[model samples]
Structure formats: C-alpha cells, structure tokens
Target: MNNLRIVVRGGGDLATGVIHRLWRAGFTPLVLECASPAAIRRQVALCEAVYAGSATVEGMTGVLIHSLSEAVAVWQADQVPVLVDETAACVNILQPEIVIDAIIAKKNLGTHIDMAPLTIALGPGFTAGMDVHAVVETKRGHNLGRVILEGSAAPNSGIPGVIAGFGKERVLHAPAAGVLHVVQDIGSVVQKGQLIAEITTADGSVVPVEATLTGIIRGMIRDGFPVTEGFKIADIDPRQEELANCFTISDKARCIAGSVLELVCAYANKA
Candidate 1:
C-alpha cells in the first residue's frame, strides 16, 4: 500500500470521487469537512460521515474521527477518515505530502500552493501554479476534467448543465430564508408542479417548494437544514433511468476524478 499522506479539503460529492479514486489506488486519503456540510447529493458524499458515524459510497466507507491518532487507526482498517476541520488546522499537524482543495465553492477559500509538497484544486476560482499546483476543470462540456497547470479553469456559467433536455429547470432553490423540510425521498419519481418540500420561515409562514420538472429526485438538502433564500436545495433529473444515478458518483465526477488521479500519479513518479 502507498504510504503517502493525502489530505483532501472537503467531503462533498465531487470531492468524494477524488477520495474514492485515491483510496482505490492504494493511498489512504484523509477528508476534511465542515461541521455541517450542505451537500445536496448526500448519498455519495463522504461528508455524510459528519452526521452519521460513517458513510459508504460504492464500497468505500468513510469513518468520522476526532483526533489524529484515530485517523491512523481508520487508515489501518482500510477506511477513509473524515475530520471536521473546515479551516484545515490539522494540515499543519498531519504534514501531508499532498493537499487537495475540493470544496467546490467556486472561489479560492484560503488554499495555497505551499500548503504541501503538492497542492491541487478542483473547479473554477483557482489559478494553476499560482494558488495551487494544478486546477481541474469542473464545468460540463468538451473541456470537463482538463487539468490546468499554468492558468485557470473555465469561468462559472451560473447555468446548470442540460440533462435530458432540462437545464436550470431541473435545479431547485430555496424561495425563502428558513428551515427546509423535504416532502419526497431522493430517487422517488415525481411530476412537475408536485410538492417536494416546504420552508418554515422565521415568521412561522410556510412556503411550499414544488418541482419544476417531471423526473426523479436526484438530490436534496437534508431535512430541517436552515437555508437562505436562493440556496440550492434540490435537483430533479428528467431521465427516469437516473434513479440509480442518485446513489452513485456521476460520470462527470468520474471524469474529473480520473484527471486528479493522473496528476497524483505524475507527481508520485517524479518523487
């Protein structure tokens, strides 16, 4: 097994793909996440370990741990460890050889090239060779997953990728600032105009969140999660066959993961 220490900042769905790939390649990658991660695709996100004791995606299990010692034990057990350190204070203590910023925040959140011997970030808002050693494309299209070593990835389009003829129509956003309570389970098929969730505002007024398209619930925020107005809350897939997609890493994620794996291997070879 490879003993190189890899620390991934963020445990969301996209980040989970990178973690899974690294682990499968014989590297024990530690995930750092916020105390409360608002991951819509919770089924495949290792950040679920923060809420539950552990989260299993495909066949890899990520166990939530408290201390550095527990992280080593989890690695020995062949499972990834999720640590709640959004600010990444543990990076200094762990002294990992690789640091990956996978927060997907579309903005650089304090990640720097000097964080480790090798540093990589995903999506836009990062400059390759400036803020990080490399940047992986996250936008959907011909350039998805391309590794940028000298510049930056494509700019955020603010538009969701078209899937089954539905683009922005498939994504659901909170209409008000309040607590969201989901009415439908993920993977459940629903019709347009159907009720999907409700938000209870501070004034005790309930705002209904309905489906904008007919399809399965691809993603949804956790029930009772406080959300701000316009916050992404759920996603609907117009393809009925996408029921299984809700529980697994997406093709786009896999594409990006492959690029990340390739970069890691290249660095490892040089070492």
Candidate 2:
C-alpha cells in the first residue's frame, strides 16, 4: 500500500471514482470540495460526506474532516477525508506531493501546474503541459480515458453520452426555475411520462418533472435544491436489469480512474 499524500479537488461522482481507486491502491487522498456540493448521484459520490459526515460507496468510506489533525487521523484509519475548500487553500498548508483537479466543471477553476510536484486535471479546459502536468480524457468515446501529456482533451459536446441508444432522452432537465421536490428517488424504476419530481416556481405553483424514458433513476439531485430552467436534475438508465449499477462506480468513471492511477504510480515510482 502506498502512503503518498495526494490532495484531490472535488468529491462529486466522477471525482469519487478517482478517489476510490487511489485509496484502494494505498494512497491517502484528501478530497477538497465546496461547502455545498451539487452531486446528483449522491449514492456513489464522496461529496455526500459533506452532508452526512461520512459516505460509503462500494465499501469505501469517505469522512468529512476540518483540520490537518483530523485529516491525518482519517488517513491513519484508512478512510478518505473530504474538506470543504473550493479554492483548495489547504494545498498551501498541506504541501502535498500530488494534486488532482477532478472538479469536472468543464473549465479551469484556478488549478495550476505548480500546485504540486505532479499535478493532473480531468477533462477539457486544461492544457496538459500548461495548466497541469497531464490531462485525462472524460468525454465518453474511444479516447475516454486516454492520457494527454501535451494537449487538451476533446471539447465539451453539450451532450450526454448515449446509453442504450438513448442520448438526450436519458437526462432530465428542469422545466422551470424553482425548488426541487423529489417524488421518485435514485434506484427507483420509472416509466416514461411518470412524475418523478416537481418544481415549486416563484408563484408557488408546482410544475411536474416527468421521466423522459422508461428506466431506472440513476441520478437525482437532492430535494429542496434550487434549480434553474433547463438545469440538469436527474438521469435515467435504459438498462433496467442492472439495478446495482446505480450504487456502483460507472464504467466511464472507472476507466478514467485507472488512467489517473497509472499516472500517479508512474510519478511515485520515479520519486
């Protein structure tokens, strides 16, 4: 087991995939996140620790920590620690050996190549050799997890990956701006045209958020969270036979996680 100090920014679903692999590989990874994370797949996201104090995904536990002391304690206990630091201010204090920006915000949020001895970023908005040491492909395709050493990943296509031949139809968006009220939660089997949620608009009138396709509720934002018109709020997986997939890391995420782990190991071995 490796005991390298790695600081990861973001605890969302995709970030959690990387964090999970790193922890399982013996690396002590500390996650940096915003005070309130907007993770839709709460079941598989380490950011859920922000609200529940701790969250378990596929047998890996992530604990919410505040200070350096708690971070070390969590590390010693073999649990990943999630810190609420959007700017990653703790990087200056912790001085970790490796830093990874897994925010998946589709744009750079202040991450730099000099943040650590070896810095890596996932997805677009980052140049491999300029903004960070390396960039991992996040767009679902033949190059999904390919590592880029000197260039940026593919640009965002403004579309979700196709699942079971259903692309945009698998994603749910808010029809109006308002507070969300969930009727069907994650992992629930939903049919097309079914009411899964409702949005309470400015006038207090509720608007129904229906399922666009018949499938399992793979993801859904927390109830009461404010959403804007056309904002992504849920996801439906057309494959109804794989219910456990809702709670497990996705194939795309695992592919990307493997690439991140490979890069970290490459650098660690060099040191």
Candidate 3:
C-alpha cells in the first residue's frame, strides 16, 4: 500500500486537489495532461507545469516529465509529475493501482472500468459500476462529494455555482471564436462591466469580455489561447476580499478529493 501508484487524468485545479490528497496519504500520483490545457485557474492547476516546466500549488510542486522514467525520478524526489499523455497511454505502461479521471470535461472522454485495478471519476458523465468503479459528485449541492457506487452524478447544469448569490454571473465566456487576450491577471479586483479580456477574431475584430459583477478575478484562461464561442474563459469571485482563495483548493475540490481518498482506502482494505 505504501508503494501504490496512482495515475490521474487532467491537471486542472480540481484534479490537483485529488493529487495533493493522494500524495499526502503516501501515494505516488502522476498526472496526464494535454499539450496545452485550457485550465482557467492556472495558479492552482498542476497542468501549468506542462507550459512552465514546473508549477507549485500550496506546498506541493508538479514537475514536467517526458517519460515514465523521469516521472519515477520525480516521485523519488517526493514531487508530482505532469506528463503529456492526454489519452493516458501510460495507464497501460505504468499499470497503476488506481486511475482517476478528473478532466471535468462534462462527458466521459473514454475512461473505462478496466483502466486500472481501481478506477474513479470526478463530476458528471460517469456511471458508477459501469464507466468506473466509483463516481464522485462535483456539483455544489447536498451530494457534492458523495461517492456513487451504483449510479451517475447529476448531469451538467451548464450553470456555474452561485457565489454571493450570483450563479452563472461570475463566469465569463468567450463571445466568439478567436485568440484570447487577457487584460487583467488573477486576483485583480474588478467592477461590474469592467473589461477584463478580449478576443481577437480572424479579421482583427476585438470582442471584449467584461465582468458581470464587482468581484476579484479568481481565474482566467492563459493569454493567446484559442477559444470558441461560449467557452468558459474566466471566473470572478464575488468575495472581493478573499484573495487567498485563488491559490488554495476550493471547498468543493477538497470535498471531492476526500471522497476519492476514501474510495482508495476502501479498495485497498478489500484487497
């Protein structure tokens, strides 16, 4: 059990929480991410290591690695490793004890029950006992982190969770397909209607994305990334004074991570 290897799909903020929890519990968790992830909360996302070579969240560091050997080296150093294996080819190579799909892509992007000895998925788009061994609820409600062993989590609501009584109002979406250019960095205080970012279309038409409510720039996509219409690009925290929240894992993320830890422990005990 001390040498258990966990492979996590995605390196976004939510996934990072699970990785952090697993690591603290004495598991070696490696992350798989795309060449360029669209994670808006880059400050807390381990996937940012793919672009920056290394990224730190809270007290943990995630180092970019090119191969399984390098990943093992990172593990020996007591650090998480991020690899460019979006389709999770390493699952077969590493033969990890656990596999977690934390992409939060709102749909099951090919994660199956047989990927590992114990498999778990976060958020919607997965059915317990079918798509994976367990499904952790991600929505902000009564079942936020409830482990579902026989059914699926709630469907995608398309509405962001309410903060300061503002549901969907705290999220910024791209108006059209183009390259995103952010004018404000995360943690910047903003007022309603303030221009935080803009999208440049093919013909050079600029579409401005403004703050829907007065708040702090909690998260925003990296500059120069291509975006499509209606794609989530930023998140504003209505608690204008809570700047530290930007770097720490959210309550929802921590709750879900705890669920994953429980599932892992349960499986290990059963074995």
Candidate 4:
C-alpha cells in the first residue's frame, strides 16, 4: 500500500468520493468536518458519521473520532476516520503530505498552499498556485473536474445542472432562516407543489418548502438542521425511476475524484 497520508477537509458526498478513491488506491485518507455537517445527500456522505457515530457509504465505513491517535487507529482497522475539526486544527500534528479542501462552500475558507506539500481545492473560490497548489473544476460543464495549474474553475452559477429538462426547478431552497423539518425522506416520489419540508423561524412562523417539480427526492437536509434563507435544502432527480442514484456517488463526483488522485500522484512523484 502507498503510505501517502492525505487529509481531506470535508466529508460531504463529493468529498467522500475522493476519500473512497484514495483508500481504494492504497492511500491513507482522514476526513475533517464540522460538528454538524449540512450534507443534503446524507446517504453517500461520510460526514453523517459525526452524528451517527459510524456511517457506511457504498461499502466503505467512516468512524467518527476525536483525536489523531483514534483516527490513526481507525485507519489501521481499515476504516475511514472522520474528525470534527472544522478548521483542521490537527493538521500540524498529522502533517499529511496532501490536503484537499473539499468543503464546496463556494468560497475560500482559510485554505492555503502552505498547509501541505500538495494542497488542492475544489471549485472557484480558490486560486490555483496561490491559495492552493492546484484546483479541480467542480462546475458541471465541459471542464468539470479539469485540473487547473494557475487559475480557478468557473464560479458557481447558483443554478443546479440540468437533469431531465429540469434545471433550477430540481432544487428546493429554504424560504426562511430557521430550523428545517423534513416531511419527506430521500428517494420518495413527490408531485409538483407537494409539501416537502417546513422551516420554523425564530418567531415561530412556519414556512412550507414545496417541490418545484415532480420527481424523486435525491437529496434532503437532515431534519432539525438550521438553515439560512435561500439555502439549498433538497435536490429532486427528475428521473424518478432511478432511485439507485440516490445511494451512489454521481458521475461528476467520480470525475473530480479521479482528477484529484492524478494530481496528487503527479506531485508526489516530482517530490
């Protein structure tokens, strides 16, 4: 096994794809996440382990740990370790050769190239060769997952990729800032205008979040999670029959993961 230690910042679905690919390729990867992750696609997100103690995604398991020693132990046991360190406070102690900022927050949140020998960021908020060693395109178009050596990917258009003739209609956003309560779970078929969730504002006013199109719920924020106005709370797959996709990584994610691995390996060889 290649003993390259990699630390992935974020354990969401997209990040999970990278972690899975690294582990299968014989590299040790540890995930860093916040105490409460806001992953809409919980089924394929390893960060869910933070709340469940342990979570399995596509056969690989992620165990939550508090310290570096426990994370190392989990890796020894052949499982991915997820630590609750939003700022990656353990990076100095772990000293991973590679660090990937996969938070997908659409903005740079304190990630820099000096953090590791090879640092990578996904999406447009980071500048390659400056903020990080390189950047992987996350936009869903021609350059999706392409590695950028000295620039950034396209900015987030705030529009979800088109699926089955549905674009923005496939997404559900919170109407008000408050706690979210899901009335329907993922994989459930729903019709347009059907109630999917409710947001209780600080003043106790309830706002209904309805489906914008008829489709299967491919993703949804966890119940009781705090959400901000206009925040994406759910994703509906227009191909209602393809429920299997709800539990597996998307093609976009796999492409990004492969690009990340290739970049990391190329850097390791040069070093």
Candidate 5:
C-alpha cells in the first residue's frame, strides 16, 4: 500500500480540522480548493497535490467525478486517502448511490433530493471538531459510519454564467483584423436585433454581425486590436428577471434549479 494520502476539499476552518486529523495520524494530504494560494499557504506544504479549481462532487452512482479525475494524480502517493466536503443542500447530480442532505431549512431546500432509492448518507449537523454518527441506507437496509468534522464549514459558494450581447465590445481581441459594422461601443445599451461589429477581408470581403440580446454592454475587445471569427466581442447583462436571483458563489444555489456537489471519502487506517 502507498503512504496515507487524503485529498480534502474546502478552505474553511472545517477543512482544517479534517486536515489536522489526517496529519495527527501521520498521513499527508492534498487540497482541492478555489481560495487564493496565500490564504492556505500553511497547508500547501502538507498537501502532496492541489487542484485550485472548484471541487464539484455531485452524487454519482459508484463514481465521484472529481475524485475519479484526481485519482491518477493523488494515487501517485501511497494510498489514496480521501476526498470529502460537506454541503447544506447536498445533491447527487451525478446520481450517487447515496444522497446526503443536512440542510438547515427543509422548506424549498428539503434534503429529499429528486432521485431516491439509491443510498442516503447524512450526519445530523457536521461542525468543526465534532464527531457524529451517520446512517447509511441501501437497498437492503442501513449501515453505520462514523463522522468527524474538521476545518471550516465551507465557503458559501456560487457560479454564474454571464449573458453578453453580440458586438466588438468587452471581447479579448487578436492583434490582427476587423472593422466596425455599426455603432458598437463599450457600455452601450444594445437591443436584441442591434447590429454590432463587422469585419472585412483585405480583398474587399464584408461580414455582418447581429446582436444576441438586449442588455447593457459590459465588456470590450482590447483597444486597437484585430479580432478573428468566433471571438468574444462583448459582455452583456441579460434583461431577464432571473438575473435578480443569480448567485456568483458555488456552495449556494445559483437558482432553485441548481444542486450542490459534496463528495467525501474517509477511511480509518493505522499510521
């Protein structure tokens, strides 16, 4: 077997707790987090691997996407320790055989995920330095597992996609070619059918571009640069009311339709 290796996700005090447990037991760790490197510098040396991107652990059947993706890299160590994170509104978007819901509110945020009959694993409330018992329900019956909380809970996270207009505005550009099709400028109020920017070939070729939606211009292509086809011309804010509910974090719901991905793998072994 390889040396003990644990890949934990989260950048809070809760995460630190889990890290501490592993270290106290003489196991190294890897952290898959999105916070700034300087913020978690102390833990950096202790981690054998780090994925500074979002660690999405949607409940998948028999396969955790993020864990599986990092398997090769983390496995390089001795034994693949564990990758785990806690979520209030945990979801099994990947269809995990087990779904865990520890959300505080049971109203709209009910823990009952859409898909059932898999397995449900949950700790009443997971907190730093807290030890708890979890009930695991399978097709046949329930099993018991021990749960210990460490480090910070988790960042109230969200991810939002921007809707942009069609234009040469706010788009990163090539130091190459293109011409304006219409009066397109940064921070302009554009309509759905508005004409944005256009390009002409050196040999008398002309191209026409149209606006994609109605919104305020948010970005621009770099100044004095030529743009190639399919380049980002601008950024726009959608006029839809949904924008009001848009969340820019990850752990939280961007909308009611969204789900939180939390994957944890913890196995007790000897040092």
Candidate 6:
C-alpha cells in the first residue's frame, strides 16, 4: 500500500533501518534525530520531516517514535493497533493494539501492556533492526494472542507454571520451605531456567530457583514477594517455540521475519 507515513525516533543505525523499511513498505519515513543539522541532512533528503529535539508526544506527527516523547505522544495517533518493539530495553509506555518487544531478550516489562493485548516475538537475540520472528503456530493470525518470552523444552515450570498460560496447565507446589524472593509477576517474560526466586531452606540456606521452560510471567501467589519452598511463582506464556526467518501470512502469502522482529515491515529495506 501507499500513503503510509512513519516517524522514526533516534537517528542512529536503528532509525535508518526502520526508515529504509518504511520506504519499501510504501510509507514515507520522517526522521526525528537529536543530532546536528549536518549529521541529519544526509538522511533528511529521504525523509518527510526531521525534528531536532526531544521526541515528545506533543507536536508529534508520525506513526512511530524514535526521538522525543512529546513528539511521540502526539504521533501516538491512531488506535495504536500494534506496537513494533525495535527498542533495546523493555519500554514502559502507554499501550497499543499489540506490543512486539523484539529486542535483546530480557525481563518482560509487564507495565508496557495495556488492555489491547501483548505478544512477544520469539527468536534469538533481541536487538534493533532485526526481523519479526514467528514463534509457535496455531495458525497465522490466530497465534497473535499472548506475548511469548524466551525459552525451550516443553515449557512447564517458572514463577508461574506454563500450564497457567492456557488456563489449564497445572503448577507443581514448591518443594521445600523458603520465602518467594522474586516470584514471577504477571507480564514478565521468563526463560526455561531463568531465576524466578530465592528459596530458603529450613537450615537457613538460600537457593535461587529457576523455571522449566520458556513463557510469559502470568501470575503470582502474593504481592508481598515471598520466596518460600511451596510458594507459587508465575505462569509462562505458551507462545515459546522454534521460529524461522520467514513466515507465510496465509496459504499464499510470505515475507521475511527476524529474531527479535526487525524487518523491512514498514518499508522492507529500500533499494
């Protein structure tokens, strides 16, 4: 399609990557760089607009944010159908139709999700300018439910067990006695063996615990944050699975996908 306008925050390599993509996708990319006039001039020729300040929600006039928040807020236009995570860390912002946190895999910033929905892209490293990787498969669009985190195996134990994701999976009780140091909180993405808490033995021994597979942090036992032997930890997002470099949209549609979700999606990297 044509007439698509995207404003990318940050003028570094990441912004350039997204910009090139938007162009290929038929969208005009506007760069919002905090660099000097000369530094941006080279990129400006290919952009629709260039703002040289803190990208804010105010006066924001694009579909994305790569520079300032004020401009991003303004540009936070549209129903915000989806959030494509090209950023590095877990960004705690407003909300969108969907949030694709596809960067360097870390703790899931549960705060970044709002009513719409959350879906984590499953793949290798989470970084900038990668491809949108497709994790599991129930169907094409049907798989766009919960946000999946990094993990392998059958996906069972975690702060919240993997079973909890499907609302049917069962959670095995804690083995010994201890306080829940870091029980998986709702919204946190977890790995198969990631540290979820610190279980203390009756003998006064503290042991950091881990999960059994990859999934999103679904629920917790208490808010006080206890790390006990039998304390309930969290539920993992069941979306974790082996992902490839490309996925077919339908029976006759196909495109490229990335590990963390960096793609020429908006513009598929120009000529």
lDDT of 2: 0.93
The best-first sequence of candidates by TM-score reads: 1, 2, 3, 4, 5, 6
> In lDDT terms, how accurate is model 4?
0.92
- Residue 131 shift from truth in candidate 5, angstroms: 35
**Model 4 pairs whose backbones collide:** none
Better of 2 and 5 by TM-score: 2
In terms of lDDT, the poorest run of 10 residues in model 1 is 67-76
Residue-level lDDT of model 4, residues 1-271, one tens digit each, is: 5678889999999999998888887787999999889999999999999999999988899999988889767878889999999998889988889999999999998889999999999998999989999999999989998999898989889888898888999888898999999998999999999999999999999999999999999999999999999888999998978999999988988999999999888877887
Question: Which residue runs of candidate 6 sit more than 4 Å off their true CA positions?
Answer: 1-172, 223-231, 240-271
| lDDT string, candidate 1, 163-201, tens digits | 988899988999999999999968989999999999999
Residue 30's lDDT within candidate 3 is 86
Report the C-alpha lDDT of model 6 over 173-205, residue by residue, as the tens digit.
455676555565545567777776566666787
Q: Which ranges of candidate 4 are over 4 A from the true structure? A: none
Tell me the whole-model lDDT of each prediction, alpha carbons only: 0.93, 0.93, 0.92, 0.92, 0.34, 0.34
| Candidate 2 regions with alpha-carbon error over 4 angstroms | none
Q: Which window of ten consecutive residues has the lowest lDDT sum in model 5?
A: 253-262
Q: Between 2 and 4, whose lDDT is larger?
A: 2
Q: Give the alpha carbon lDDT tens digit for every residue of 51-110 in model 5.
A: 322222221001122454554454444333233333322234333333333222111123
TM-scores, one per candidate: 0.99, 0.98, 0.98, 0.97, 0.26, 0.25
Clashing pairs in 3: none
Instruction: Give lDDT: candidate 4, residue 130.
Output: 92
Which residue ranges in model 1 land beyond 4 Å of their true spot? none
Which candidate number maximizes TM-score?
1
